[model samples]
Target: MGSVDKNPVPYCIVALMVVMMALSYGIQSADAQVITYRIHSDIFTELQDRYPEHAEDYWSSVKKAIRDGINAWIEVNPDLVVTPSHDERHNLLIEWIDSERVWGVEYHDRSLGYRIGIDFDSPEPDEYGASLLNPDIIKYVVAHEMGHVLGMGHSSDENHLMHGVENPKPKNIFDSKGYVVPHLSITDYRNIGGTQLDVSFHLQGYNVHDVAVVDINGTQYLVASTGNEGLHVLDMSNPDQPGLMDMDDSPSTDVWPLEGQPHIVQMYSDGFRVWSLSDPANIILLETVSHNSILDATLIYVDDTPLLVMVSKGLIQQYDLSDPHDARKSGAHHDNFNLLGVEDIHGVVRDSGSTYVLVDATFDGIQPYLIQPDKNPARVWHSFDQVEYYDHIQRIIEIDGSTYRITSTHDQIELYSVKPKIEPSDEDPETELIGHLLGYTVLGVDILEVGDSVYAVVATGPDGILGIHVGDKGAGKWTVG
Candidate 1:
């Protein structure tokens, strides 16, 4: 019932309840580390003075891009906290290194931690200068520097965020083929342990909006938004060679593959469509859940049974998909929580048993609700305020005996482990809370646990996505290694 804010500062205090436990348990800390980032105030001030006509717009655009880049980097590694001041305990600082050329650099101290410096100059009224003001370019620069702070070294892989400046082709944050590759690699997380890694990959070709992964017949499929008219399906069997699968007028807004089933459920601007994919090479249409106002649907997940949960346009809808060929809506709810008075529902995640739903309450923070399938009216079990500025929750998995959630928002990826609330009356539930962080500003995320490791697939940009692996953690804290 309480409103949430976009900044997530309020929730930080509440989240401290869990974060403190995590810190006390030895979650790696970026403490007593002095990181200083000197920004060239003169360059920006000069740009504002010279381009008085469009300087404000240009500066605002670049700042937005930098914010995007920072968000993208955070989606991959949520542990590295970035602050402006040169604090001994802070991990990263954004500094202005040059004023004329407009270049930025990130310096990491093995002893002190991470530091980043950015340079921006007045454009020469040339195409390159104009491009420098472009949002995507600015985002790239911030992402690049953040990568250095996260302990990632420069990479030759052109698609990677750590790729050097010599090759500067902006990667689309979202590509129709599937989730875009992220900037950080498996090795990056291995080096940082449980700390966050700031890295991202560029998306090339296609203005991608959203992405979802579905597994059909042992093969993984990457479903994404293509243009404004249709959906693009990519075979992710091989991470490198991603190809497309064709679908008709169904411009998919979201996709969810029913676990243990051969059908993939897709939400489009027009309505909802089900595809029979028993045969991976060929996907056949099964059913459609049409709603006139279904302009856009963002997130989808499967509950304990065969129910499909979807969030779109500030509303939540549940569908029954017991029969792969037939899908029908069972119930729905509208979320009206907002601090900025903006009606936007960004992300959602379901518990393993599908008995509960964790939703981003936007500016109001994250709220947890208990799902009562049989009850006529759904009930709220417990709702907590000030969880985090969670744009997207990627993966929720139970590692060892604890459940953890991976969340992305505002240039950082955070891992939250559920702490049981002991009650005097009822028995404590056995469920665990686990989620993943992804998206340009940490819009969405998905994660899975295999063997002793956890793999997180995150949306880092409009077409940017990254896969991260967190190795086994002892009883203390969850570490990346």
Candidate 2:
């Protein structure tokens, strides 16, 4: 037996065969790209030769570990199709190695593609008798190695599984939810909102800037844009257990998934892009519209016409998006109206089932507009509440037949009942604040409906993701999960 260090060491590699059960999971969809893995023969032979007494247990544990690792990735991205492969271009190769040091090694071989080598020899348990070969520990190691296969480099965070060190203690890896938090990221289950709902999950270490949800056919998905790292598409078909379905590793700041269509308009610093998600596993870039002043945008359907509404320096512009590959300017609303210094636009959302649009213009507050047939929109109202500097108006969703706007500013989120002044009125339509929650900076937000309850999932920069139950205690109220 050799002592293991915090880093991978050079060792002689001996391929050993192993008999294992490799479960294959498939995604039934059109022209979907699938990631395949092959189990090398070295595993069973190495385990049987090294520890014949526990060879069966070792083989079973190793098999389960691989399955568990793949499953974890599927949970985060549901669009992934990882199945057993017996071909030339296997994405991953799993094998057993008789190594003196290191529990596992993930290396790329020209002929083998990506390969993972697990140690066949188990190290002596610590004083507490916690062996390195424990089933849960092995699963965690395999999951960490899988992260490398998925193109994630070693994380500097010591609490992360990709930190390059394998701590054999189970207590440090698993949380009360029975979830392998270390393998994913440190997730805080404590209540962070007023609703008392548990924070479902967190993609720690990633600076998530914005999120949007869309329904494809009968399935629902959420798109999370993390700026330069790219965008993540998560399947929300099972609201309680959202699975990551796909990811586009392109720089993105905001994403708006088109309604009743498998397309999304993603906005970056200087421009925006259109993507087709017909094949969630293989997201295709359809078009890019570059504008130096373009800050943020959203897709809205006026009557039956699909329009791309964008905000810039001091103007709100509309483009015809009937043809997703090409965008042509149709209408423009200059800032000469009621808008005040509209320099920074964080987000835009159309009031549900209405012709009104709400813009989250930081410092300027919420700006409401009425869509017209001639392409030019009319500014209905502009008001600022001097409580704090507003960042973004997350969404304007309909709950219990009432339209409510969710807005975030600094370190707090507020829900307000929005009534657009469609008809000429003496008193402005009720834009009254219902309830608010004070917390960390909430950069982006989206909603999920489970049965009769509505959950608001938010991206809190470094705080990761948190879930809130809308109207949990009663109507017009929120509770943190």
Candidate 3:
């Protein structure tokens, strides 16, 4: 038997044994930061062995106990996010064992990671016969064991959740939904990391791929494209309290709103479509263009004419949208810049009566092109210094006669100074790195200017939408708020 003092978050009633294996639980990454746990099959088998007829009832009760146990810690500190994994490999494992000594045990093995065992068949000598099988008792025991997983130990107060023994009638730590209501001490607060304003508000959906915000008649509307849920239009007049105004049943993978117009370009797996958001309450599809392998598309304006740029495979094709009902292909650029896996079209920039298109070539880096009404897009510059990184969306702006581009890439939001070279000049256009804000899976970025401050509202995959302080006017400094 090994000592229990050395294991991480150990609260074992029996002798602890050390095993040789790597732990997979509690592994935090740039994309995901939640602790994952899996339920062992033996837990259900144990219930089936004891109560053959009411096995389903016992099975559901046990699973709820485990979930409520994890929720207890989250109620105390929301930063300690926990979710169940159906996969065999996970951070923590819950199981049932045949034992009469302890109600539950929280222990760790080097190879198997952390695990909690509940002795459901144990019989107490008092009025509580086989009380360990009681749902309320099981809930209390699970919560107590889960506390150990959060680095908590036995509390001297018998009324506390971390108390060693399970009470016959435990404290009302459960709600009407059978979820744990946490009761934490000052020590618990000091021991755990509390939640931050990382996530402002989240609308539950399935595989949301892209989003675009536009204002129609002084009312802001958000158009989101999802993998399985199709399109959703939400009223964003209230930033914190957005309401789902309407939805379209056509599946889309990306979206871009046409500025100053009540139209939106939605990209599908095989083609692109244009939808009219004139009435946010009723989103109507206007036109559809079917091709194949369309990765991303954006609407840009050249010489006051609306043009749609679509990147398919490795080809950058242009379609003139002069007639809102009819989209005509004008020109296409199939160069050898090796842009087969173009991840995104970072919109366009209008400077000195010239329009420039920016693209995120996953393999070749950021590529800039000078586009004209009836001519092929000419490559102005290729950014190789910031190469080999998967860059996403970008927002361009001109501040004090200087052009700046803010782009989201991999796990960070980057800022660059874009200076287009004048014609007849031998020098190429210069793009210099300005600054970056470290983030996680930044999928979309939108800049909002309020008074003297500019903020980057970024949609980070699982981390939610983060509003970062880009910088104040003339401050020339960026910070994460």
Candidate 4:
């Protein structure tokens, strides 16, 4: 007995319209989609236990509650349509249970739902019933499950309905007190409208762990390796779902897309592979240069003069990719020279028009490596130890003239501000640590930034993928879904 509420407040309507306009104008690739859900009752005892005489009335009320929650979320995000399904065209399935045997099950169709199985015939009061029967809990469950149907995974943030557990602390949705929580927070609305403008994506598999983005011209590509599947390329003419372009059997760890050229230079475990994508479907392989001890190539940068900087395991190698079709290794240098002591490098970004490189270091420690590419040592970068120890550095972006780095460690996300340092004597300056932003314990992150805001696609354990908004320069944070 699932129902849906059609009418919503005017403020919610305005917010949804704004969100849709932003998505349509900002992100030109994919269309904003919606989802519908349906709840079914399995056994008669299940309803009878809860409402002895007025089972039908109670069922309708429960359905209405679920509908209200769904409508609330939709009012905030018009792009996310939540409606009730009368037939089989539903995105999610809900079932009321009467026993523990059917506690959790993953259906074959990849469609997931929740089961409220209870022992109605038992003489004793059901402990699980007490928690599940709560109106707020019931509504929360509907919202949480609908989150999955809407493509939101799970999240470690306790405040999120997608947080796996049936009931999370701070009982109320709005605040610590038991108040009626709105579907989307202010920060959430802003993020959905902001981050979609930037076209950036992260790729991970095998030893290939890295992030990359297609620049303004739709021709240039930039990538940074995080010690796994170096930097790889995908054809993005179809921006909604880009496909891998470089099919080289060798493991390419990092890549940097060259401006004014139809080719992207990538670093593989064995060497460097330059690819020409004028014909994106069938990529033309240009050249491959071999390296002796280069275990992984983390990042690559090419200047106006066409000098290439490739950051690899314990070293940063520079190359000459000016010839697009014919790339050659020119220079190579090691950072923290000793291979045994060097930490894994995650992100590397060269400040626009500057010779220095902003490197995000993780696993070894949360420190900023400011590298002066002109110096002989190239290790002249200052190391800041302000950020706590984290295992992985996921993404880094330059927003509002400030550099922000995101790291994944132990089950949490840490954000840091990078400020450039200027010394009177030296031409190259050092980057100072400004502050830390919001943190959350989540499985993985797919983050992007557009204009002044940041959005993260977080992987919640059983909850699924959730889109979260971490405000400008750590100003504020909230869950959008």
Candidate 5:
């Protein structure tokens, strides 16, 4: 076990194994002096186990917790600006280790790397294992450890986050007691990161989901999802000031338009609804295609036949929308596991020749299928552990030869050379990270290419419409999202 928890806070006998440090010599004392250190926490089983359930905000919350903890220390000292370590020689690396006796072992020095061996699934009669899931408690633990990194000592105050059982042990209360329901401790940390960009249009705090540059007739329009506001169409004919074109009450989880047909396919509960865009002024609902709570659907024209690939409930089905009303089932892979997730299908992509299809979702990572001549889908590849490592694979977009996957956690966009690995491998494809999209939360993204410029209209929950103009290469232009 580490030293007693330092810097405690408001509590009612909430048992927690908090920030206990084992410091080395030469580190500066955090005595009324501001200190900054780059810190990085590794993702382990303790946090990964909860990823699927909290897929929407899990990774983002982890990012927020560490950053917020640093902010709390800054509150104690005005000059502090401890941030995530990029390439700093002297920084903190909060990591995990194989331990059997203790929840964690904190080893520190004035040197480059100080370790935080986070232990998961403690032995019998230990509830600390589960408490690690709570972000509120995580904040306190992080803040307390941060104090040690900044050169602070143990405090006897039970209200401070830096309080525990050892060191300045005045009176031991709930010494061996574990498990704590951490209250939401509002810290004074206010670093929103440089990712947050200002937007001209006001969203009124609505989490923007889908932002597609719709093509109606010959002009370009923007159809955005405003949470419970169904869908909002904006006249982007004049790119400078986009005017609201129309609004509907279908409240879609995902939406895609039919090729050259002023019609859109919107995924609703238990099915999908077709809305016509013939009159940009009035987006009319044409029909409903009910098939086991359609979680997600995408439009793709196979040769001359307009086809739709949808995942709902526990089945992957393809329908021929060539005749609109009399849509026929063309292909299907009857399986409950490759179906819709807690939300809808995160993303869908198909090969240019339409030979194969790739799908992604919340709990499920990414799955690839081979299109057969009999119109039956065959599983080509799948690996939930690999995909979930980054968080939920909510939406995937294929550009050039690489596939871009956007997850709900921290709104991260990862690019992968997925062609060669269409077949399941011993390991997942090595993905290239395109950095994280700046937003409190995100939903889906559609890749837009205009001449030589490639931009993505991302659906952010709180940050509104974010336009990411990704370059042909490098760390693309990330404005918001």
Candidate 6:
């Protein structure tokens, strides 16, 4: 339903097709302009059929909570959200079904709308099944189930409401007593789930400037910027208490890694500083690109050719590092943005053969620019609408096929699964809302995958650095970790 003039539509704009079992498995792209849900008569009839002995007021309370849950999300997002007529079936449906196996099942119908089924037969015997009438917890349950409809996966962080399983242990935000109720975590706001654990470490008692994680041999090290104190390399084998490895003696503005190649790190300060990690314990500066005050940079590989793309104030420059030592300029684009004085830009990520260029807080919130290196190498797709309420964009990371937008507004990060745009085309690829997480004072982010797990390393401004495990959200395994 959403389209762009010169701007390309984002994958999350239109709802993708979902089967009834999509929730049990997974679904994508439910970001319709207006998503509505109605309490199906089947749910009322199910209550009327089996629980005829219960008071009518009890069922009414449960129904209200479900509606309240949907309304709560509407208030949080920028979209026009509403509930349809009492008798009308809408984009999303909430119903009660006879299923003793599970308490709730969230899925999408053939129309590509979502439906959440609250099992009337089972009230969660292990976790206060009878407390379904408690609207507060019920509201949380609705929100959790609704998150999947919005295209969110389970959160690895147990503190988030999207935790897949029940936690008997008491946590700061989760209430396992009775029905499991968890606080709704702040996310991207296109709307998505998945809890994130914030693991932090000190950078020589300094407020960390920026951080990058690189694996050398079998050891992983954190190359972090310490203001003017130069670079501090920390041993991240134990991510909790990172031990300092070495320092660059000269500080850098930011850091990035060359894709596929290990031990090779890029630091940007007055210009680009390349380093070699032949020794995991020590890092050596290899070459320097004299371009001054580079805002952001990303590394891309086409065939075996390595391309280093950097964005400055007014122009985006590309360099071909066919020879790592003898670097050469390959291509450059001066007129990338139509908006004037656009300077809050932060990050660039590449996924599925496409390079996504991102800009933050430019009238519209953070949006993705899908750039493909085709015959012309200039094929780019502009990202979709913005949440008018949020702040500027901070960082953006694209992994697997998912795009994460870290925004300045409320320190929120939004997750969206972008349809594979292997090549550039006028027909905009659709994206679905994966979920969101709120990180306070988030300055930078780096997402890395090693085997079955994924990790997100965030650079918080004053609070220091945070090491987060993004959880196995994509794996359909939703047990509370």
Q: Which portions of model 2 show Cα errors greater than 4 Å?
A: 1-198, 237-242, 333-341, 346-392, 396-406, 414-436, 450-453, 471-481
In model 6, the Cα lDDT at residue 424 comes to 73
Give per-residue CA lDDT, model 3, range 310-415, as digits (tens).
7866688888877657778888889655677688776565545577777878787767777887888777864434322223477766654677777765545666
lDDT for model 1 comes to 0.47
In what order do the candidates fall by TM-score, top score first?
Answer: 3, 2, 5, 1, 6, 4
Deviation of model 2 at 378, angstroms: 6.0
Ranking of predictions according to lDDT: 2, 3, 6, 5, 1, 4
User: Which runs in model 6 stand beyond 4 Å of their true positions?
Assistant: 1-204, 302-304, 334-410, 413-439, 447-454, 472-481
- Provide the lDDT at 120 for model 2: 37
Runs in model 3 lying further than 4 Å from the true structure: 1-206, 334-369, 379-392, 396-406, 414-439, 447-456, 462-481
Query: Total clashes, candidate 4?
Result: 30
Q: Write the per-residue lDDT of candidate 4 for residues 309-389, one digit (tens) a residue.
A: 445556665666678766655665665544334344544544434444333444444234443333332544444333323
- Superposed by TM-score, candidate 1 places the C-alpha of residue 406 at a distance from the truth, in angstroms, of 2.2
Task: Tell me the tens digit of each residue's lDDT in model 2 across 48-155.
Answer: 777888778867866876787677766755555778887657856777654543434545555455666665334332222123344444555566666556544444
The TM-score that candidate 5 achieves is 0.46
- lDDT per residue (tens digit) for residues 1-481 in model 5: 1233332333222233323243434544444243334444355344456445554465566557666655765554444455555565544565554344454454555565444433333211122222333455456666656555554455455655545445643434322112121223422111122232222233434556666655765666677776577888877544446678788866666666566677766765667767777778888777787766566666655566666777666677787776555667788877766454534434444433444456664576666666543387677754433333322234455655556654455433333334346566435555655444222345666554444445556676655665555445323445565
Q: Write the per-residue lDDT of candidate 1 for residues 279-301, one digit (tens) a residue.
A: 65677888877776553343334
**Model 5: worst 10 consecutive residues (lDDT sum):** 174-183
Query: Best candidate per lDDT, number?
Result: 2
Error of 2 at 114 (Å): 57
* Backbone clash tally (model 5): 20
TM-score, structure 3 vs. true: 0.49
